[model samples]
Target: MTKPQGFVSKDRNLHVCKAEAAASASPADEQPLLGEPEQPKFLGIELVTLKKIIPLGLMFFCILFNYIILRDTKAVLSVTAQGSSAEIIPFSKTWVYLPMAIGFMLLYRKLANFLSKKALFYTVIVPFIAFFGAFGFVLYPLSNYIHPQEFADKLLNVLGPRFLGPCAILRIWSICLFYIMDELWGSVVIFVLFWGFATQITTVDDAKKFYLLFGLGANIALIFSGRTVKYFSMMRKILGRGVDGWAISLKAMMSIVVVMGLAICGLYWWVNTSVPLPTRSKKKEKLKMGIRRGA
Candidate 1:
């Protein structure tokens, strides 16, 4: 009889079978069963993730740059204002800034109930820009008339030298107002608005990866704003005497602030426009699915 097809003799079986040999092989000895997936990335961040983060980072940079500038400028304006000293800072922080912060928190809670995020941002931000611009251009020019010098002097006499700090704050009330608003900028913009928006849009995993990168923009702002502050501080020297250089510097700083504020608004608008609503919804949905699967 002829040998049957698909039959293996005992001699053939004694040798290593091809299928079994392949199965026994290590992964390193074989090619991948499927092609590896390709991801477009820059500096380890996926392109899509970078697209979402860069505009947000620019927004953060502008916000932080304004904050740094205002912080330095406010200290100089408050401490050097007529009758005021560095001592006013403690009183301002304890009494004025604290109360304003508390009031803002309460107001924010109320606003959150009804207003959209963009409306809330503009509402909070525009007033700051307006006030700073007014202070630099309109209000500071009238400081001699606006400040209650005689009243502060009378109060100082009655309250004695012990009350100089409070009296000083009363005298330079416009400067005090500037001080408080600058303090609020740091707290409200960075903590409440920017971070809140960031966390809302980004998934947890993305936040973990990119929040540090976002923070790096703020750190870089320190360098840029510091150099700006230094330049403005030395403007009187740079521009020479009898030129009202400090006033010029104030205008320049405030103008930069307005520009940066508008840039922040533009970046905020870009983020909303560029990152589609569907992408955010999908990210949230995917995050929810991940949570469910993990559970």
Candidate 2:
């Protein structure tokens, strides 16, 4: 006997469904044996991933390159500031740097309310570049006139020889200022600004893959900056002892720092504008919403 029409149609549909399922499964079942083709990669990263990672690595390289040069230069200037010695460093860290850091944090919080992350970055970094430029060209040249040598002498006498650390810090206040600002650049710019920016835009998977190379870039910076410092150090011999080699080195180093600072800003702007950063649009919207709420 023939089946009813409704039942016949239902049976036909069931067969079609089974056939579709089997067809889907056949490829999945064979997938393991056939093996998926490997993605084309460069230096262990796919091209798509490299596009995101390269700019970030280059930015890190510039940041760290300037940081190391400034760090080494600051140490030299502070320690060799006539009356100052290594003893002043601990005192400066405790008495000077800590307070400056706290003040800067408070200022940064206020700035965050008023600015976008990109604007905030430029605000923070431009001042550092300006300060270093001014120090190298103008302030260092006027150190003898600006430094409070007589007051430091009187204070030292009053406090006795044991207070030389504090006295030296006061005597070469410009150098101390440079030292504190250098410390802040490392803490604020490198650690807080650059890494914070990196973490905000990068996904967990991308960060894991990219951060290792970012670290590699920093290591390269260390080597490069060391060589740069050594080459400048050896410049004194070529120019003779009479030409004030340290001054020349400071000017040259600051010039490089300024150039690198500009490079960093350029890289940051390009990444913000050009890269297809994840959640970047969301970040901008949130920033705008925050500003509106603040207003």
Candidate 3:
């Protein structure tokens, strides 16, 4: 040691290096973390709250819309006419579906972007008005056009040997679209809206939760909507059949869908408006805040 006056002993050199490494590792010795920390609790709470409220609201709206459509249309395919003269009630309606499907798909994509959650809810109001208006303005008068005898005759002709299988399949497919649109208006539209919203929202985990909650609500709606058709037919006798009863129920159901659509659109708007851009600085800040809050 005397010979090397400027040099530290090996033990002392090693000790100094180890002390520096430990100090570097200690956050207390360094500057505070710069960004917000992960807010697991806050996120968990928000997710849970949304999961409960949104699904329940959707389910109620679904039930109402199903009741309306079922009451009005009865959703039955009756073969009323005999032999070559037979007809089906839904014949013309099937032709209308191809166009409606195209329109619906286009509207869905556009509205998913243009409408806020609030506006989407209001958009559904159109359908409500449309449904009742449709019944009074179109279906009520058309009900007179629904001749059971003629329908049967048309059906028999369509199902005769040559056209039987293919014609039946086409009719069934048309019926499927009719039922799908009627019963699933809210669920389907909302699901599409949510898909757009999920892409907008940066939080992948939150999107996952929201999707699952809404998906469950939709499945439940599908099951209930199918079962309710029978009950609705029976209830219609007591509910009355004149324009007023039909109009009122149809309006009520349309209102439900419209309102629910608005809510979903509103939520999308809120999420888009509220969630900040996920830049590196913001993410770091979020991380720091999250850690501090956790501590």
Predicted structure with the largest lDDT when compared to the true one: 2
Rank all candidate structures by their lDDT, best first, as comma-separated numbers. Answer: 2, 1, 3
Q: Name model 3 segments beyond 4 Å from true.
A: 1-74, 77-95, 103-191, 208-210, 223-231, 239-295
Model 1, 137-207: lDDT tens digits are: 98887899999999999999999998887889889999999999999999888888888788776778788
Which scores better on lDDT, 1 or 2? 2
Error of 2 at 162 (Å): 5.3
Give all TM-scores, in the order shown.
Answer: 0.78, 0.79, 0.44
Order of quality (TM-score): 2, 1, 3
List runs of model 2 lying over 4 Å from the truth.
1-48, 280-295
Per-model C-alpha lDDT, please?
A: 0.83, 0.85, 0.47
Residue 175, candidate 2: alpha-carbon lDDT = 92
User: What's the CA error at residue 257 for candidate 2, in Å?
Assistant: 0.8
Which ten residues in a row are the worst by lDDT in model 2? 286-295
- Distance (Å) between predicted and true CA of 70, model 2? 1.5
203-290 per-residue lDDT for model 3 (tens digits): 5555554555655665676676555444544555677455455444444444444554455445545544554534323343222213
Report the Cα lDDT for residue 288, model 3: 21
How does candidate 1 score on lDDT? 0.83
Q: Output the better candidate (1/3) by TM-score.
A: 1
